[model samples]
Target: MRTLAVTTMDPRHRVLCRIRIEGAEEAEKICLLMGSEVAPRRQFIAAGATELDEARIDI
Candidate 1:
């Protein structure tokens, strides 16, 4: 198993989600999965969809 640190930043909302994963190559995979799931939700609440696309994540 490998440990990965995932960090996400939503500039529009000024929110951040940092997660640590324990698995084999799960860090990068989980980061994208979580971003895909949350980006849309954030877009719905944001001024526009593009806001979420601008979101940044460091893995």
Candidate 2:
């Protein structure tokens, strides 16, 4: 498991830092806990997806 600090994005962007999930299984558990909420879990997932997209482009 690894955690990363993420800040300094556009101010309009939501900031979710130090959210540590080990793998897909752990992420699933988190999703289950979150349970259909839209504000935060969606935001976090969107942020992660955005980061992954950016990383793919960089590579």
TM-score of 2: 0.26
lDDT to native, each model: 0.49, 0.55
Model 1: CA > 4 A from native: 1-14, 30-59
Instruction: Provide TM-scores for the models.
Output: 0.19, 0.26
- lDDT (Cα, tens digit) per residue for candidate 1, span 1-59: 32333222434534555554555364465445456588755644564445555446433
Q: What lDDT tens digits, residue by residue, belong to model 2 across residues 4-45?
A: 323334454445645455566666656653576667777667
Worst 10 residues of 2 by lDDT: 1-10
RMSD of each: 13.1, 13.1
Q: Return model 1's CA RMSD, one decimal.
A: 13.1
